[model samples]
Structure formats: C-alpha cells, structure tokens
Target: MSDVQVRGARLEDEAAIREIADQEMAAQEALDPRFGFRPDASGRYSVYLRERIRDLDSVVFVAEVGGAVVGVAIGTIRKQESLFELRRFGYISDLMVKPAARRLGVGRALYDRLLTWFRGLGVRVARMHVAARSDEARAFWKSVGAEPWLTESWVDVPAADGPPDPAGSEAKPAPKRAAGGYAGDLPDDDPSPAGMADASDDDTDTDDDTDTDAGDEATAGEPTSTRGADE
Candidate 1:
C-alpha cells in the first residue's frame, strides 16, 4: 500500500492537477457524448485551478505519496435560502485520482480530508454529483453512506419560429389540473412528451461551471472530466 498523505493544494501543483483533470475529462466524454466539457488548447484548466486555490469559500486538497501528488479533491461551502429556512452545505465540485494511484486509497484519503474540512466549518452535509452511467462512482458513494435523494432531467426547447415583438401580447398560462385528478399517475401508453426528440435523466449531482471567487456553482450531474476520480 502507498503511504498517502493529504494536504491543502499549493500553486506548484498545477501541472499535475491539470494532467489528472484532462484524463478525467476524457473518461467522461467516453461515457456520455452529451457531456459538454472543453478545456482550452492552451491548457486553460490550470488557470481555472489557480483561481480555485485562491477562493476563500472553496477548499482544494491534494493527496501525495512519496512527495508526488496523486489525487485532488475540490469543494465549496454554499449558502442556500428558501422560504422556510437558510442553511449552508458543502459541495464537492471536482475530484480526480491518477489512474495508477486509484484503488490504493488515494481517492479515499482525499475525500476524508475534505470531509474533515467541511465539518470544521460547521457543514453538516456534503453533496456531489456522479455521472449517471458510472457504476464505480455509484458504488463508491453508496459505500461511503451517500444516498440518492433526487433525479435531474433535461429537455431542450426549440426556438420560436419568429422573433418576439416588443409589443406582443402576454402569453397565457397553461390550465391547472385539479388535485387528485386522473389517478395521479402517468399513462402507460406514451410516457414521453409530444414533439420532444430527446430527453435525458442524470441522477448524480456535479458542478459544471467554473469555480468563482464567490463560490462554486452547483450543477445537476457530474461532468465527463471529473468522472474518473469517482472510482
């Protein structure tokens, strides 16, 4: 077993971090073609990491064995407000373990340190989005005691035939169905919506947007680049 040590990431770790991120992205693309992730040709992922390392609300940690970084985990604490209450939770935005170092506890070490950090900040729950097709990730999270609480689905709406006029009349709202109507279940004949060519469902939650100084944006499913680390 490798003697893995986890610590906060530094500026010097950018190169290795980018390499791992690129590999993760490649694996994601293979798993789902619709995963829309593209790093610039000039290695823009490093720039992205640089910003992340500087964010106060975000935490980035790297796992090292024998003085070489083998894995990374990034997370952020975000405040959420609803009509009932306001609370904060931790979101694991990105995690990657080099192919050779995986299954050697590097990824787990990274995650453990991240969870510790989250707890230190009074975060009670940590959330992450795994790719829908990544069985490895699903099993890993389940083993770690994470449960699936929601499913995210997407549908693309085609553009209108003509541009909207500035003085156009307001659109009417769809009719509201009465409560407890129609057996409260979908019909078995046609489960899909009319005129919709494709619909996709992703159960895992991942952040696809770039990390900002304020905090990381929360996304619904894991992007292709970060899927490999879930193993």
Candidate 2:
C-alpha cells in the first residue's frame, strides 16, 4: 500500500473508476455470480454511481498503486423511518479491491477512508452484507468486527423442504453485540437509534436493504441494471 493514495473520486475519474469496477466485476463473476457485475447495465450503473459521487452526499473512495486504481468503496447518507431510525446515516454501497491488491490492506485503507468520511458527515452507523454461505466474507467481516444478526430468506415462502427455521428466536438483537451488526455502538454515539438499524453491506460492504445475489437482497436505493451479491 506504499505510495497508495486515498481520495474522493472525481467525474473525470469515470474511466479509471469503471476500469477498477470492471476488473472487480470480472473477479466477482468468477468468484460468485451473486457478487458479479451486470454487463447490460454498464452505461447506467456508471452514470448512477458517478452522480452519487458528484452529489457530495455520497462518497466514493479508491486506492491506487503507482497510479493503477486498485480498490474502490462507495456509499451515501440516507434518512428514513425504518426500524434503524436515524436523522442521518452513512450507507456503504460498494467496496472492492483488485485481485493483485488483495491482502495488501488496500481494502482496509479504503474502508477507513470511507468510514472517517462518513463519521465526519454525521453518519452514525457502519454496515455491510455478506453471503450467509460465504465463509471467507463472513470471516473477513467478523475479523473487522461485523457480526451476523439475521438469517435472510428469499420469497418469504411457505414451509418447503428446508426445516422450519427456528421461528422468531433468532431475531433477538445482540445486547453486547456491537452495532456494526456486531460490535457495540461507537463511543458517545447514540446506541438505540443505531441499534434499530440492521445495516448490512453488499459486495461493497454497504447498506442492508438492497438487491444482492442469492435471491435474498440487501438494502439500499435501486441501481438498475447493476448486478450485485450480498446476503
């Protein structure tokens, strides 16, 4: 990560950003279709994310090695009356590091940049989503202090072949479990309002309620033509 700079993406960065995204997407598709990029929504997705970046309310951070874009993290501030009610929130929508950049802490650096930016913006909660079955992702998030709290179900369907999942028993929120879905709330930060939010990340380590892969979607604004995977 030496010489790597973390900075806010610019409209002029579209090509480089897209290149990183495309590279990340290729890796994702190869790793899991649920986490891959949408080939069809290429034009629109780029435009949408760039718009978010331009708005300032949203943030997009990246790590570059000697000028080669290696990683990116994207998210925004959102307000809603949902369970995790808050006057404001910093929502992470996407995060990725190029294959060559893995294990270099590029992901962590980008995460911190986005996190510090969010904290400065009054974002009280940090969240991301991962496949229930993706052990590596699970481990990664856990290692970073993100713990799992929900068992996602697609269709909300009737009892099928799977065992009747132990009813509401699991919905119980973690008491000592911090708010990042795992760790406790940030020091001096409001805990109740933050606790109510079940924020989660997509392939980007972002918000909780959006369309992810695995039939079970994460939470966030709909970015059409965008293919993504999260729990």
lDDT of each: 0.54, 0.47
**Model 2 shows how many backbone clashes?**
20
Q: Candidate 1, residues 74-158: lDDT per residue as tens digits? A: 7777665443252666666666667677667766666667677887888766665555566655544444455554444456644
RMSD to the true structure for each prediction, in A, is 11.9, 11.5
Per-prediction TM-score: 0.69, 0.62
Q: Which candidate number has the best TM-score?
A: 1
TM-score, cand. 2 vs. native: 0.62
**Displacement of the residue 35 alpha carbon in candidate 1, Å:** 0.8
Error of 2 at 115 (Å): 1.3
> Which digits, one per residue and each the tens of the lDDT, describe model 2 over residues 1-231?
256678877777778766655554444345445443445544644776567678867777766778877666676665644455444555545566554555666655665576678767666565444443333344334444554444444454455565665673544554664334322222233211111111112222322322222211122211110112222
- What is the C-alpha local distance difference test score of candidate 1? 0.54
Model 1, runs deviating above 4 Å: 39-42, 84-86, 158-225, 228-231
Segments in model 2 whose C-alpha atoms lie over 4 Å from true places: 30-38, 82-85, 156-231
Please report the TM-score between candidate 1 and the true structure.
Answer: 0.69
Residue 229 deviation, candidate 1, in Å?
A: 5.8
